[model samples]
Target: MLVHTAWNDLPGSVRRAVVARTGPVRSVTPAGAGATCRLAATLQTGSGVVFVKGILVGDRLAWTLRNEIRVNPHLPGIAPRLLWHVEQDGWLVAGFEHVAGRHADLRPGSADLSAVAAVLAGLAAAPRPGLPVRPFAARWSGLIDSWHVAGSTLAHTDMSRRNWLIGDGGARLVDWATPAVGPAWLDTAFTVVRLVRYGHSPADAEGWAGQIPAFSAASGESLTRFAGALADMWQRQQDRAPAAHRGLLVDAARAWCRYRSGRSAVLMSG
Candidate 1:
């Protein structure tokens, strides 16, 4: 997890720059330890509420936030609008419209499933705006071709519970901190693991994934390879690091891989 910076920790000049865009800063609330930016917060401002994400100019991770800014402009209505951005006091910050919502519940039988599906469907249909977005890692090249990843427009490669929010309007995906160029079906694939993690059986989770046309069209061979490749990639990490274990997704991938091989019919929640 990233060591987050509180809103108050922002340099005075940086805060002033943000205020100029937001009117007056009344309260600042950090959005927890989000994956990329150094600062992520919701601020109560004189004009209204604005969510902000930022990074120090010299931080090695600044590229992540920069990609976020580039991609935000072309995002669909399901994403929060980027209101403004500022660079001051060696900090770079971007302000967004503060949307109100609760985290999506992806567990079995939850009403939020369709809502989450809608967001992914729309995201798949969205036109790829021109940007310097990178391709999916070369390590999974076989998964790439089988899934037709090269045919993708734009994808929010990271799909976690926290990245999805359910508001009165339905579901909206957030945290484009690390976007990628991959098959439209890839996000749906990422989501299958989430469904399995939450309680859905592999068959049931895949049944849910099948509702998305892209995933539905995926060949069984491709789906099998996708699962195996995803599992293997992180397993290698655990092998080398012996410590840095972000293995929940890996475990989910393994379970699905096993089921695809006709190995079992159970939801193995590790």
Candidate 2:
């Protein structure tokens, strides 16, 4: 379990690093939600408010904080701008331009769906960055067919509603800590599972995904393989270490696989 550190409790070296950039700190408010990070807060400075997230240097997931710093620059307007990053007193912290927006509501028929679609399309067009992160095929090697993993597109991978912000400009993706270079449609596929969690049936979630150009262009055979791969992956994760929400995700993934299986049957019959 992740333990949150109160802003006042941050080591002096870390606070000094933040103050160097933002000047005197007026207040600190916990901001955003995620299980991966030990600290996420908005610091009010004399200049302005900036969002900062960090983890202990010894934590295994500390590398993800560095990855977020490296990936945020490539995201452009699709994510909050990275102001700076600091490593001090056994902690790694990154500051970002604060975005005052609510978590996107992704239930069926919400206007946020279109914005989510637009964001996915934009991400599909982003240039691939030079990163050593594993490709989708290699990451899920045995779970998915090798043929479907041959694309250089950069994918955010994790598209939960908590990772999105519905701001004045539209939906913006956040927490790009687990980006991958893989099929352009992979992110869309991940979102389909999230849509299922948000009350959309598997069929409806797949329908929403199909509207995106990248996803629409992908072959049904590949999509079915991907769907089954995700189901298997989530089921294994749940079995090894049960999480309250992991079962829901596993159910959603299985539902998507069933939908694809039925579609494949129909196609074969025709």
Candidate 3:
């Protein structure tokens, strides 16, 4: 587990690094969420308040912070603006525009579903960033048909509810650390799995994801293949390291696969 750094306890060198860009810090409010970053807080600077997230310089996940900084500019309005970044002493910190909002409620029939769909649509429409990220389809290459693994869109592969913030402007996607290049509909499919974990039936989750034009336009066969690939992957992950959350994800993935298979059979019979 990552060790968290309290805002007031940050090293003086690190504080100076932040001060050089944002001016003197008036106050600091530590953020108590997210697993990847140990040092995250809202810094009240002389200019304004900004959300800053960081990790120890030697942490293996420090690369995630760099990745977030690299992708933020490419995301446009879909994510919070990356104001600045600092790598000093023994920490890597990046400041972002502070967005005040609540985590989206993705349960079936929640109004946040519409906002989530809109964000996914925006992600689908976004132009691919120039960075050379791995193609998402390659991750499941031989497990699924080759045709299912096509498209150049940037996908925010992780779509858990905690990553979404529902502000006055609808849903804003955060945590660009795990972005991938993949089919336009992939994120929506991932969202479907998460929706099932959040109490939606597999069918209901599929229906909710279908609200987005990109997902709606995808081939059912491709989606079924993708679902099976996800189920297999999650099952292996659970086997490798059993965790309560991973177990839930495994169940959700299988539920989605079964839903897709049943729907395919119904369509063929009809």
Candidate 4:
């Protein structure tokens, strides 16, 4: 029962341009919505079904959308298929080939873990040309020193289980805008949190975290420092988000923190 947003009201020119390329849109289904002016809509077109991520116009909004479209294709099947993009109208609309799959949830299994792991693995590999890398390394390096010790090739900063879409074609990651140019552990840690929420054993989570340093080091960032940066990032997001959602994120972070702290105790005991 998602409601329409003012963003849903596309301008005549934008509508015509889309129809011209894609043909009349049969319907626009609300796929998902998130904070920060991001709305995912399923656009049914005569050619085929596509997903439109409408980002509000202005500010640095256009750059974020542009960054996503630029990097998503580099990841190929690992990410959604990009169709087209236009910055003219108030909203930046980028179309992707529809991917059919359920979001990752808290359920224990090898496949889910493996799928998530693969995504992180891919990120550790590296980013392609035409994408900026220093933004991540510089920020990560700064965080490491500021916090203490610390770090994706692919910047899937929002790699919660929910972001991974497992479909018949293959497992594809949605929400590409968050991609960055840093160590893979950053994304790995982010993804691990989601699995932990699904009730993954503390041992498993710790094991994953322990391995993060090596992965992140490939990008020249220390695990300890990167971790501090991540903590700060999470806090900033919680602070910036609306009050209602802030509590939710804070609770989630608190739970994960508790689990992580307990793991440290176990390691010390061992």
Decoy 3 TM-score against native: 0.93
Runs of candidate 3 exceeding 4 Å displacement: 141-143, 239-242
All candidates: CA RMSD in angstroms? 4.5, 1.6, 1.8, 4.3
Q: What overall lDDT goes with each candidate model?
A: 0.79, 0.86, 0.88, 0.62
Over 4 Å off in model 4, which ranges? Answer: 1-8, 126-130, 140-142, 146-152, 208-221, 242-270
Residue-wise lDDT of candidate 2 within 11-64, one digit each (tens)? 988999989988999998986435667889998998899999989989878878
Candidate 1 vs candidate 2: which has greater lDDT? 2
lDDT of 4: 0.62
Per-model TM-score versus the true fold: 0.88, 0.95, 0.93, 0.76
Candidate 4 lDDT over 1-270, as tens digits, reads 123354347677776777777888888888565543456778888888988776657645556677777777687767877888866567677888888788765456556555656666665665444655444656556445522222225566776556788866546777766666554466666655555556665456646645545353433224433444555666777766676755544455556666656645676799
Best by TM-score: 2
User: Which portions of model 1 miss their true places by more than 4 Å?
Assistant: 137-148, 238-245, 263-270
Provide the lowest-lDDT 10-residue window in model 1. Answer: 261-270
RMSD of 4: 4.3
What's model 1's overall lDDT? Answer: 0.79
Across 8-116, the per-residue lDDT of candidate 1 in tens digits comes to: 8878889888888888889888776555678888899999998888888898788877877889888868689889999898989998888899998999999999999
- Higher-TM-score candidate of 1 and 3: 3
Backbone clashes in candidate 4 total 14
State, as a TM-score between 0 and 1, how close model 2 is to the true structure: 0.95
Candidate 3 local lDDT, 1-270, one digit each (tens): 478888767788988888999988998888863577888899899989999998987988878788899889988788999999998888888999999999999887799988989989988977788888778877677788777967899998998888999999898999988778988998999999999998999988888787788899999999999999988988888855548888999999999999899999999999
